[model samples]
Target: MSRFYEIDPTPENYWRAIILFGRNTASYKFALAKALLELHGNGKSQVKLEELAVPYAKHLAQHIKQQPKQITSKRSSFLEQITAYNQGQLDHDGLIQQTTRLGFNNVIDAFHKVHGNDVGSRFFIDQRRSHGGIELTDNLNHLLEQLSAEDLAGEVEARWRLVEEAWANNLSRQLMLVEYEEHDQQLIGIHSQRRISLTSARPALNGYQKGRCFYCYREISILYGSDTPADVDHFFPHKLKRCDDGKPIDGVANLVLACTDCNRGAQGKFDQIPALPLLERLHTRNEYLISSHHPLRETLIAQTGASREKRQDYLQDAYNCATVFTGSWQKWQPRAEGVAVF
Candidate 1:
């Protein structure tokens, strides 16, 4: 069993063999194993029959060859069960063996057999969750290193950089068009008809405040620029005709963090970020920051601030604008009906 699943993770030099040549030829496993044996380990131990990488008896012509669709998920019984064992979730393998998810068993086994025990191979396994339960915990760090040398990373980073450079040239002109809240120490200078190319800003939105979502606690994705990452939000409603322009706050002052849902969403952006009572104060202080809900005004000031008076109100308002939706350190939970997915 160890022979089928185990791979030596030590001896970093062995990894380069697979990392480099595997992209061009079907001889990837042989080339990698030979490199390991020759440069680092015993040369005499090379895989003799190309048994390591070749899943079928036939030799593959290329590295990126479309795997033959001829092989179906149906397996020859015990072959399927053994796969369950290596996946680490050996516990669930038995339970799922006869279920509709059976194809999962065969696929997992074949996957583990080919990929060995390395973390990168887990992504190819039949089931999304393997018998061996832990995935990203064990997978990400290991695989990232392997992929570091892969061609794809270089291409994505390079393409993204060009787009970014083009955007920077347009930033100053764009900033001039925005409208901000006319208040002391506002978080961001707001904008009007401020449009950013989401494609170029994709990296910043996800990478903007770090690897996390600015408001919600989801991990930012590289692809998120297509629509998932955070966005610029208005501190005050632009619709009430209170503000002269439509752009949300622009600079660090009026700007706070927000997820895509809250920005495009119909809920009052500023009101949702601030605690309910404090929102009332913002509404009263500036018509631009007006809180339409009169009934909730006093209550917001009472619970969210340090004291019932003016001094505490200033502190709370400042805190609300600066750190309100930005950090995950303090979690926010909106009360909801009995059942909810988020």
Candidate 2:
């Protein structure tokens, strides 16, 4: 019966067979790998997989059931021979023959004869990410219960050990890619029109009234559908350009929460800088940009054709341009009539 499949029918490990007979489509590849990981994590039980695995999972249920038992014999079915095979009981060729002698070579012949190395490499990456804790998590164990279990022996066991050691290397998924942090509050409040929109003069609206394009204010979804008020902005972006390997800059030093309209309109009109969706979420409540900070303002000035002194002048300019001629400051605002240099 074991001859019908390889010792490691782990569809995960059998690439050649998969490539020869199966169309290696992306969806197929991902689905298979995901299924394999799900199975391994669940301790290989089909009865538990009804919901996520659906009908196909049910079909594989029996095959998964019988396979594990065969490999995990209750009384160590081929005990003495397994002992000899495990303890360097034979030469390399002899070990190969040991399978024939034990009448189990058929289970592995497919593995030895598959398509290419792609399957092996992918399976290896997956294995590296499924460590003890990653697989043993509450959600994961429940997930595992749905798939059939495998006897964690031989190559599987050895590979698992190596994976555990290299577990930290697998961080992309573990590092949950979220646009905003939990502390990020969506700012979507209707402020009274009387609020001095720094074009109304505080440090806020100086950029546009002074000639630089005022960037768009952002309105990020706090809980997925909330909008925020517009904050002041500088459409021409400025910041420390990140290195090729560096992550997106999320520090307060890097972002200025702007109003939604401003953000949408700014759309990389100037230098390439990422938008701060977090602050935008909070903007629905208030039109505050990094409106209260110094660095964001300083960076903005620096990005303009400002010399260091000019940048410093604005950063500490006791008389903010927006506040200069209160009438002009109050009246000067960003109009689309400006040049569309973008």
- Among these predictions, the greatest lDDT belongs to 1
What is the lDDT for 15 in model 2?
Answer: 29
Write down the lDDT of every candidate, Cα atoms only: 0.30, 0.27
- Which residue segments of model 1 deviate by more than 4 Å? 1-199, 220-248, 251-257, 260-342
For residues 1-342, write the lDDT of model 1, one tens digit per residue.
Answer: 111113443222223212221221122232222222222222222232222222211121121132221122333343333343334445543423432233233332332232233333332222244333212222323444433222223222222332222233333243222122334212121234443222223232222222233434444343433344445444433332222232223322233334555445544244434454434433333321112111112223332332346634543444444453354234233222122111
lDDT of 2 by residue, 74-180 (tens): 44333244344445564445433442343222222232223332332222221112331111223334323422222111112212222221222222122111111
Hey, what RMSD does candidate 1 come out at? 21.6
The TM-score measured for candidate 2 stands at 0.17
What TM-score does each of the candidates earn?
Answer: 0.25, 0.17
Model 2, stretches more than 4 Å misplaced? 1-224, 227-255, 258-302, 305-309, 315-319, 327-342
Best-performing candidate as measured by TM-score: 1
Question: What TM-score does structure 1 among the candidates reach?
Answer: 0.25
Least well predicted 10-residue stretch by lDDT in candidate 1: 288-297
